[model samples]
Target: MFPERLKFPRRPRVRRRLGLGFVLGLWFGFLFYRPVAGLRPLREMGRAWGDERLFVRKDDDGVSSLSEWNVTGTYKGAWGFLDTTNNSSRFPDFKKSNGNSVIELVSTPTKIKGVHYVQGVIIFHDVFDNERTVGGAQIRVEGVYIWPFRQLRMVASSGKGGEFSQEDDYILSNPYHLLGVFSSQVFQESPRDKIWRRKNSPVLYDVEKHCNIEFAAQISRVSSNQNDGERDNYHLEGLMESPSVEEDGDCFSPLLLNATSLNIEVYYNKAVNYTLMVTFVSFLQVLLLIRQMEHSNTQSGAAKVSIIMIGQQAIMDAYLCLLHLTAGILVESLFNAFATASFFKFVVFSIFEMRYLLAIWKASRPMNNGEGWETMRRELSVLYSRFYGILLGGILLMYEFHNYIRPILLLLYSFWIPQIITNVVRDSRKPLHPHYILGITVTRLAVPLYVFGCPSNFMRIEPDKNWCICLGIFIGLQASILLLQHYLGSRWFIPRQILPEKYSYYRRLDQNSNHATDCVICMTAIDLTQRPSDCMVTPCDHFFHSGCLQRWMDIKMECPTCRRPLPPA
Candidate 1:
């Protein structure tokens, strides 16, 4: 009942339009305009930092030109911190530089009469930028072929990317030649140049007269991707240093050495050793399997063998884990070790190891009671879940202190340890299962061996090689046993059922042929006309695909028809 004029509601169109306009302005200011503004300084910085030299001239248009620079003698090791060091102190008078954009080599050594040589592009980075971050040009090596021939051909290199240049022959007899060319027109020019923030934009280095060494490598093997002659495999930076101006060589420039390249050959060796170790362990696992199967059937000769193998396997597993954990510590490039060595991490790992040991000990007791094992499992599970929740929560909340990543890793290890223990313990409960026994035994042994080799630095204690070797042998024995049991299944004591060869492949029966309509055992529908390889019919008349039945039968021996055990062949 207020005055009609006062009761009328105001419209929001003007306010909505104003709000939209503000949002649009913000988007342009922050997202679009700001980035463009930053790029302006970035380009200027690139051009100002390096030389704009002309190396080649075909005509007045300057259609073909190359920039040249060199670094002779050892400049301040830190002066050209971002350039590759292959050309640094390693090569005297190393001159390496590249045009701002992509360049093409029109002729190779074969095209002109001369000695064969390698030619590759080199991009330069600013010294200040190099000191601040990891910066270097990407050198993509095209495949090297014989030079000093009539005509020459080049193609893009290949590996993950596809190969190029399938044509093989060279041109008629002539001189070996190599010509380099760059475009006169710039891909990026002023007026149309985009600007961006220095920090946000990629920092490019355009060096002047000084030689910039970006990377240095001490290689026992040269050109891992190529199998060319030894000359192509020179120690390092030979090409960057030797070229002259008449031959289109940039002057020697400073080379910067950053981090050292990893020894790839060492890694390859490690992989081989690791694989051999795995095979040996697998063999032992198989042996344990056979012993378990033998014991289940006769229970006469397998007890001692089983016990010994289990012990050996445990020792081996623990030792291997320790080796890896210790290696992780030794490699200090990453801060993970310091984090893992924290008090929290130590405590968590200790708790996890203790829980696993307890489970094993409880299971191995003379008393056949399983209550202790179950109790320990429950306790470990609760602690594991609780700690994990806390760790995850802390990390998610960004409350993960600098000190906590390591603790989390240890706690994570705990989760897996229990799982490993559970798998062995649960499976071993079957008594005659060799695979389960071997796994359990190995896990138990691994713990002590790991502890013995503790503090991997060998400062405290070192595992005897003889003992380790013995453990390896024992693991191999267990692996062999498992392989045998895998063939035997649960009824290793009972002779296995073997169907007629005719039933191996699935086949459809002819409508007129006298054939059983259902599986002999289960009475299930079976298409007789289908090949035996494709379908299988049990003795009770249940029909199924051979693959499906084979897989199912591996786990179950009884026929679907009568729940009767499969007949011994």
Candidate 2:
């Protein structure tokens, strides 16, 4: 049928190979080459724009290189647009030069004393490629480090392809001496270089729009291979600026002057405030825990507390600690920023909340009802499955719906709801002290508010006014409901019309019949002739002196005679 498509797979296999090749070719082309607008081959890429080669000056400053200073490490910075995009008169033509690539300089030393070879990859986008449609280019660069002037003189050569993915062909692309020493301005007038788009096969933007551009930057040493001074735990401040470099008729690379450098430092300072805020919140938790201990017996009194709410708080602390700890260990630069904050969180969670959580778990356990072991095991398995399942499912949900993080936070903070229901369900009275409720609510809001409300947050997250206001209102409302439950009775909010009738222990008993019964606790005759408050009645119709039963319920909630469960006062 259908011309015997593969012909039973003959021994020659030529037809099979041809068919497989056709399928694979289509798949590869679909996966790798995504042709979009403004993409063309080299010739159509306008005139091959930029600098012509000139002689490099190697006559050195004649000053000896510092023994400890080695320009052999990585430096990260960004190509800037800055005030230019405001339609500034000075660089009006720069409106098109909007695409930027994050520059990472990997340097190594050579046999020559003050000379360090540098290779840079222009990843994500470059200055020239205007379309920004397809933006990846690699530049193999070598620049002489001028220690006297603190500059990378640009007598540079260009090589293509990616990082060391291929064999060490860097040797072939040499005269390694022909690194970044520009006869133009690179080592000359202002230390700026006009990068050329000609000698390279265009990697960004199918090739057509070859807009020549200039790149001006300043290099500073903030850290080193040899670091000392303040003993700081390793934590990196992840600061990001706009990595966009644009292209027009002429590319205008931003000349980073003193103002730009000052701005960068200012941004870094803001991150310090973030870490400080975290430390402050951790200390607040300590104070809150101490206050709670004085008010209630957490192990036994926590029976009425919502275990989910407490465990949710612990989970939040654990995640925060793990995140900061992992970041500190992986990146040396991050150690100072994340390490101390993580330690504080670890101490607060491990020593403080973990113990609280275990106590809550034990106190909140379901009472045994003489069920078989298999039934209990199945129930526990289901319970554990729901917990870890929510943990994993939440990660995927946040990834898929990250825009709805505010709503997620709202849901997270609704942990108080379980306690409110538990109070009504069990008809318990004053399970949590008022001080604990108020303290926990306020402390929990610290991290979320700093992240979403503060404009100067280190994470560079944009502040959301509407979301912040809504979150505050939502949390306040929850607190208000809990406070109402504390003062106005758990069932006070329920309409009287719908409330089920409850048994009353204070109704006047049969006067003539009960006047003769003796109160066991006080070893006195019952004062039944007095008001209803003077006599207490148990559901079992047993009588006790009112003052005696009140004091006994303080230690244990049980009827003295039958030892049966007693309702809360």
Candidate 3:
């Protein structure tokens, strides 16, 4: 018999909830609250992109225009201007200019098959007011294209002295080429002036089309006090490079092609949708897992440990949902790109994956040395889980040093799910319920599909259609399995049955028996005279209430007092 002092401790109540609440509160507070000025909540800071406007002015003409110039660049294959700084150094000669303002322009022309083809321009501007007292300065120019296309033709001077025509013939011919025009900026000493702009006309598509593009930066600066007739003189100098013509068939560099052709909107939309889907699915799974855990009996050590693991996973999933929601909001808000959020999300996911693997390792211990196929299956799980778990964790750690590790990590993560699910199914002694099977299968398939389909890294090609088709097949298979299981009226989830012969073997105590004899399962006295059928005596001579014994047996086929194994149903 088990010693009375060796009684199992009752599970703590509200502990998991308290931990979950604490974690969630910390996360919300970090993302939504700030103690420092200028450090607004993520949600509010994100609005700067939409509300901030750029004012550009041409110094000579004093013509000013308003433009929304968002940061644009490629991040993990997605295009947008988020978390990117636009700052360039001043030219050597222009550094001595009045306000330490310098603008350098370079133009390159490409010739293909003895024909002049494309022209590209790169402009670098740097301005600084050393005198702190100088209120502000402005730079403005006319006839500058805001969103210049790949193909551009400079208009000839309209017989005016040192002045080119404000209108270009190519602008009218290619109406779509004009995305916007450059406005003026009234710079303050507090925020120094810096601008880096690159524009290239599209070269011909044929690789045989040897094309070159040339560009130049034209800028003028006027101080805020210039209108007061103060003795302030601005100097303008132009430096032009001799055009180099190439006969080679290199139409354009691959990097240049990608930068010009990329459609930011498409990738941005895909990211938002993908994050939303992950959040929804993760939330649903958390709810379902919690329900399953609550219904589970935790009398056995393994069951108790599994319950704790599930609770941890559910909490992690809830956090993941929050992260995804926050990331989606920031990306959509145009305040920040997905880079920062994606990194944090990846870290959290890596930690969660490690914990999950640990749980699986613990759960598989009992079957590791068992006889027959169970032993082989358990060994397989242990080997793969250990190998991949170590590899994945190492890769995540190494990713900080090298970005190329991301693709490999994603590939491994995709396959890890299926391997885990296979082990789970193999480890189960009884057939899994259809709902359980469906959930596992869908999650395994969906994660890989989402990982591979989403823009997680830089790639020259889009997602393959074949992979998408395979993903759809997996989804269909899950639905079919659910339908088939339901049609067959599977008894997978039914409670264990107690044979009449087994119950009849338990003898009921009489009224003369000691009133202090209590059932081990419920700690209640076995009052046989009050209700004879409700009391039972175990084969070990220990007594218990019938209902208590039945409930105990439902969790494990063992005697509550002696802990002896009972006959299997």
Alpha-carbon lDDT, every model? 0.34, 0.53, 0.36
Off by over 4 Å in 2: 1-259, 262-280, 290-300, 333-340, 365-404, 513-526, 544-556
**Runs off by more than 4 Å, candidate 3:** 1-273, 295-427, 430-433, 443-461, 471-554, 557-562, 565-569
Per-residue CA lDDT of candidate 1, range 1-569, in tens? 56765545434666788999999999877765554464444334333434211111122322222211111001001123235454433223223422222212222333322322233322223322222211223232232222211111122222312332322111111001010100101111122222221232332211221323222111122344552332222122212221232444443443322211223233334333433444344455445544544444321122112332333233334434444444444333312432332322233234433333333443344234545778767765875565446545644543223223333323322322332233233322133454554464564354335433333321112245565455545545544444444454323433335422223223343344445456544446566565556665455555565655554454444565576544321
| Tens digit per residue, CA lDDT, model 3, 11-59 | 2346767888999999977654432222233214223322112112233
Q: TM per model?
A: 0.23, 0.56, 0.34
Which number leads on lDDT?
Answer: 2
lDDT per residue (tens digit) for residues 516-569 in model 2: 788888888886777788788988788887889877665456788888877766
Query: What TM-score does prediction 1 earn?
Result: 0.23
> Where's the lowest-lDDT run of ten residues in candidate 2?
177-186
Q: Is candidate 1 or candidate 3 better by TM-score?
A: 3
